[model samples]
Target: MAKLTVERLKKQFGTSIAVDELTLEVAQGEMVALLGPSGCGKTTTLRMIAGFVAPTSGRMLLGGNDITRVPPHVRETGLVFQSYALFPHMTVAENVGFGLEMRGVSRAQRGPLIAEALGLVRLSHLADRFPKQMSGGQQQRVALARALAISPKLFLLDEPLSNLDAKLRAEVRTEIRSLQQRLGLTTLIVTHDREEALTMADRLVVMEGGRVRQVGSARELYEEPRDAFVAEFVGRCNLLPATREDDERVRTRGGLLLSSRRRADESSSASTLAIRPERIAIEPGHHAEIKGQLEAVTYLGAHTEYQVLLGESERVVVTRPTPVRDDPMLSVRTNDPVSLTWDTEAPRLIPETAKD
Candidate 1:
């Protein structure tokens, strides 16, 4: 609906800084997710965008218009909260039409608009039901419908699907993504859940300690994290302590040499290495780089997980897609000798601290 530009956005609650020098841009009709752990300033950042919280310093531009000082009601941005925030006494249609009503639209004008919004969320059949009469998923959809009724330029959701059960959460997120795309709506989602952000957003902005950590596509953030915090936060990673060896290599503590990406901005040439568990392959040949004993095996429906004990103190976890044909891992036992290795380019070496 609109391009959102947040420049040098900073917020301080007295002496405690909530968001520091944060800057990000969301393209028109693109969905971006603010992903992080609890208390990472994601919610605060969303509030500032919604104009509910004042920024100590910064500017917010919506569709080339400055909305930094605009009142929330007049910002022309639709916001949906985690709690749904629907009135219990009102029926579904009434709740969806409430925004239009507040804008002084007549009852005749609100009917089709409310119906269209409800249809977008597939809740037209439940228009007469109250919040207490519907499931968590249904209630949340109603909240989404209500937000869309105003035809706002920017759509914002703060943990919008967190209240639903796991199955419902997965189902609803897909529905929301499809709906947003169909309407070409510019949307921003705030989520702590990794898979939710990975699946729903076109791009991700990982934040921590009142600052942006890394921003990229889901694959970039997962496979090419800029720092250790991002590597561990975005996905399953096996972090190994290593000594840097020249420009593109690191020697592990156990004397295993591995290739890694080295950055020039890094003060130290060498740093800790991050390797995804799924990238590690189990080799049948005895000449594999690292030898270990398979400590445990877990059989997930789609993937088989292996826990291999490397040396005495370090254990590496590997997850591989289940083969179409049944294999040895199905009958694999603990304490079996095995060798693990990975491609040269899969491992990423990142600094202990982020580059300014």
Candidate 2:
């Protein structure tokens, strides 16, 4: 395993800037996930590290050796693409051993390495089966085994689970996490799925518009987003427009008072309130209450989602988990008078300058 580092890596295509002065590090045996929407430069950054795309400027180093200009084959990194590029004509064993073959490993010595790689992905029994004979999950595991057989210093995956179904995605998610931990591989994954990145990565690197937005553990980003983009992107959040009163007070522009969850910086001009849907209570409580009409209700089995039209101008959404005893919100319907409230410290004060 090796520590990977990139310093001010940049990539530009004509008038379009794909990545802008990106800098980050992955310690030995650490897994970091890069998350963002399409065209956010996540994939371009990964390709730069893999040596498939040369950086327009800046440097990349693996274990202190500069490999910014190194060719892909000489970089010694294993890559698993979104599409598992296994040869349909080759058997599983042949597919996994292709990397070794290209590196000129003796034919006699490749058997044990192939078997070990297959065993790691729990596909040793299907080694002789062709790609046409295996399931999608099995095929993906074979691709992973192929990458592992080369004993790469850094393991890079680009949306490794996007092709799998929901159930298969969950199963493979657990499998990939466990496999990475067992091998202690220094890995970097590029994904647009927040939940996937949160569950798999030790730390998250969120990006947008060719720049880094925030870097933190999953819980930190979820609980205390530094900006409005992060607040709404990491999870389901409502950014209510608010007017500031002195330094400690704020209310919705529509005149609903809300307590700030976090203390704002003395220099900050907080003009918005950020709150998660699940944090709001369905009924009146000791906290600040606001009246609205329940415009829509969606029964999502474990939780019910309500779109409340506050007065005639604002809308606040609430997601409440189904209770074992009873939830009065269940009988509530559209246009009904709904009283919603939240604890004194549930909403966050977002400064106007921090929103992106």
Candidate 3:
């Protein structure tokens, strides 16, 4: 395991800046995920760390050793690309032992280690099978075994599960996480899938426009997003225009007063109120501070999503666990007058400057 550090990293291609002044630290044996949408510089950052793309500026350190100028082969970093980059003609054992061969390990010295690597991924029985004969998941495991056989200081995966089908992806994801935990490897995974990042990472680094937006654990980011971008990117969020009051309260556009931690700062010129759909409660009576007519209802498996049009200017979406079929209070119809209420602690205030 190794502690990886990147300081003020930058990369550019002609007039386009791919990565900009990004800096982060991954502690030894920690699993850190770089998460963002396409073109957010996640892959670029990964490549820089693997030494496939040299940074235009900044430095990289591994285990407190300066490795900014080292070549990819010398960096001792193992990379598993999105496509299973296995040799088509080589059998499982051959592929797993290829790294050892390149490093000049004798054939006798590589056999048991190769077998152990295949067994670690549960591919020991198919050691003689070629890549074409194996399933996608099996081939992926072979790739993983190949990377592990090299005993790298840092393990870097670039969307390794993207190519698998949905079901296989889920299964293989759990297997990979379990293996990483058991081995206690310091790993960095770059992925566009938000759920994958949220579930697998010990800490997440969210990026946008070639810069780091926020870095926190899943619970911290989900419960308290620093800005609109982080809130909306990590999960579903309802953003409503709001103004700060003299008493440190936030007033929504529908004239609903919501308690907030503090007023928006001067940089927060376009402040808005953000709330999760699950936080809103749907009731029949008129006790709600905000009322709206139901516009649409979507029946999800565990929950029902309701879209409510508040007055004429604002729309709020709320989701609640589906009620029993016999429950009369929740069998709501379109255009029905409904009351929506939420806990004062639920609404989060966003400064105008923080609005994305």
- Which numbered prediction scores highest in TM-score against the true structure? 3
Candidate 1's residue-wise lDDT over 17-113, tens digit each?
9999899999999999999998889999999999999999999999999999999989989999999999999999999999999999999999999
> Number of clashes in every candidate structure?
1, 1, 5
Of the two candidates 1 and 3, the one with more favorable TM-score, higher being better, is 3
Colliding residue pairs in candidate 3: 268-352, 268-353, 269-352, 270-352, 271-352
TM per candidate comes to: 0.93, 0.93, 0.94
- Global lDDT of each model? 0.88, 0.86, 0.86
Model 2: pairs clashing at backbone N, Cα or C within 3 Å: 261-347
Q: For residues 1-356, what per-residue lDDT tens digits would candidate 3 score against the true structure? A: 79999999999988889899999999988999999999999999999999999899999999999989999988988888888889998998999999899899999999999998898899999999999998889989999999999888898999989999999989888988998899988999999998899988899999988899889999878877777788888999998888877444777887766665563442346477888999998876456767788889899989989898887768888998888867754667888888987776787876533533
Candidate 1 stretches greater than 4 Å from native: 259-270, 284-286, 322-332
Candidate 3: 10-residue stretch with minimal lDDT: 261-270
lDDT score at residue 301, model 3, on the 0-100 scale: 83
**Which lDDT tens digits does candidate 2 get at residues 146-255?**
99999999999999999999999999999999999999999999999999999999999989888888889999889877777777878999888886664445778887
lDDT of 1: 0.88
